[model samples]
Target chain A: MSDLKNNLPVLYSYFRSSCAWRVRLALTFKKVDYEQRYIDLIKNEHKSEEYLKIQPFGLVPAFIDNKSGQTLIESVSILEYLDETYSDFPLLPEDPLERAKVRALVQAIAMDIQPVTNLRILRYVGDDRKDEWARHFLAEGFTALEAMLQKTAKKFAYGDSLTMADIVLVPQIFNGVRFGLDLNAYPIASRLYQELNEIPEFKATHPTKQADCPEELR
Target chain B: MSDLKNNLPVLYSYFRSSCAWRVRLALTFKKVDYEQRYIDLIKNEHKSEEYLKIQPFGLVPAFIDNKSGQTLIESVSILEYLDETYSDFPLLPEDPLERAKVRALVQAIAMDIQPVTNLRILRYVGDDRKDEWARHFLAEGFTALEAMLQKTAKKFAYGDSLTMADIVLVPQIFNGVRFGLDLNAYPIASRLYQELNEIPEFKATHPTKQADCPEELR
Candidate 1:
């Protein structure tokens, strides 16, 4: 029950989707006033015919910038769009080299860590060994993430300022924790995760804070 | 032995690795003068101590820009860096929305299709069911990709011009074909794939053209 004529950006998201959470974080960090339309991923709402029309990929975090009439799908693409279209609190660094570094970290988590452990992938990995699978890959990806963070991190994953690296890192850490991963093994990543969690931008957009989060999970 | 003191950028790559192939395409398309240093993934050379220093993630396609003193990992990030750093034959569209569409298609292949079927993941998936898993996910991801291309495509995945979408599509189609996927199922994607293969930039940087490609495969 939404109108593109409203001129307010609407985000189709699920409370617990990590990909969805990354977009929510970018929007909140950019301080963009937006409306959220919950799409229950568990209910296969994303796979609906109507949803597929809006997002050909049938994924959460399809963003509609009503003013620009740009309906963007894919979290990485949506994030880059938000950063490009909005001026405030840039998600990426200004210099192309620095931006590449930050993006490298983003893909390390987004492509390497999160996608493999996603709900659909987990289901395919089989029920009995899913947790083991998630834990192993999460640990493996994080081992390299920690090494990269050790080389680049200061206050955040990149430098003192927050970039896409931190935006990608925080939610991925949440997933790692969900898989019961031991943070102690990755000291550098563990420290950044703890510090990033304390920031208001990250805290406000946390999965538990979403309207659609179940009472029991909250 | 490669030296950082050399003016030319050194690309650590594997001949058959799709992730590495993406960067090679970007570099070739941009017409940048560079040197290639193969990291044999099958031989576990990527996991070697020296290779770990170059790419802590132990992945191929780690690019070192000697002029900028930037060492970049991740093929997506590397391609963006090449496009941003070298201006000739831009890999992305000038318009922000157009760029997002192109990038969205890139991620649809890079993240959704490529990573799940990567060497490491396939090994973990077990030999018996690995092809089944890869074929299933590839088909699922391609279905969405075909739907997206149907709306936006003309000669390329986005428009008549070459963009990142075509770059991503060419390599993924290579992977899909290697896995015995039927290109006839997705007409739009199939057409783009056929068209992209005709381009010299894509043809020159193809996996089979790499120095490390096996004699029979080449």
Candidate 2:
């Protein structure tokens, strides 16, 4: 484990949740020390009475700032809250137009892609149909995302600096690869993910690196 | 139409889109006079070559700021841009914690609910399945939102002040009613929507008041 600062915030997360991964990446990028509290999602720990009080939706990656007594759910909202609260390494651009672009790009992933392919929803449809549903939805979203990324990308989704869009894209790409989706069709998205995976923060926050992940998954 | 101010921004919108109604509500609350350019979605004006150049997604409620030569898409982004650019009406709260709460509420509606029930996605799935999909998805979202709103609401979604959350909720509830979904299940959401519709700005921005809406629909 990395050396964490004293009295760091606590992050309640599950090993494989993409939404939790987004917050983990943001915390790593911001270099904020946070203690990880693993929620055994397979055991349905998230739906336990204790966990539901922290997050009514029973979603993973509920953040608790001990210093301020603030508990935040919803990954995007948590990211924005962190960015505003810590003003050190700004995740958002100062320019209004650029900020709007970054936000729109992030929303493209958050709103358009991720929710439709979430594991809980996939499981809701049962194993027999899960693969087909995942592929169809992810492919449809990725095609549009690939086109948009090609228009705006320089080094990352919105140019040189790694913004919130890059944070969101990496995990979705991971899920895409796991599902055996065709990466060739989304060359820009694939290339960007290849490049992003090399970064230390992303490497450290990979799902396999999480403490709760079994040795085989690792 | 209501005492126009020369050189104000131009809003590209559809008559009945909830996303478009969001911008309309914001413009009214901010008391900013602007021109409205209607895109006839029924006739496929939004997907027209001319419209695609402005918004690649062919989504309604793109805004063009004549003064700054900036164009913005996505209703939430546009609302944020407007709030930041025109600091008069204060659509978001000054406090970071409150701002986070408001954003979480807005996103619950915009990201979680509206996308699933959007017109374009509905058409993609075909008419036979659209109503079923819309009913199931809206209820899933409304249950969560109703719970959250019950905790945070004073008169609006986040207290007495009219914030962006209220702007998003009113239109979504309007859409819910159009689909004949039962509002009785979400009493808080229904009450808030009823309160919001009584406001002059919201009343003026109603779909029935739009120039292009058919007489039968009106």
DockQ of each: 0.87, 0.52
Q: What does candidate 2's lDDT look like per residue over A116-218, in tens digits?
A: 6776566654687678877887887787687677778999898888898899888888887777578888888988989999999999999999999999988
- Pick by lDDT: which candidate is best? 1
Q: What C-alpha lDDT, on a 0 to 100 scale, does residue B3 get in candidate 1?
A: 72
Q: Which regions of candidate 2 deviate over 4 angstroms? A: A1-6, A124-130, B1-7, B124-128
Tell how far residue B162 is off in model 1, in angstroms. 0.2
Backbone clashes in model 1, listed as residue pairs? none
lDDT of 2 by residue, B77-191 (tens): 8888888777888988888888888988888888778876788667765687678877887887898788788778998899889899999998898888777568999999988
Candidate 1 lDDT, A21-129, residue by residue in tens = 8988999998987889999988899889999998876778899887576688989998998898888999888898889989999999988888888887998888898
Candidate achieving the largest TM-score: 1
* Cα lDDT listed for each candidate: 0.87, 0.82
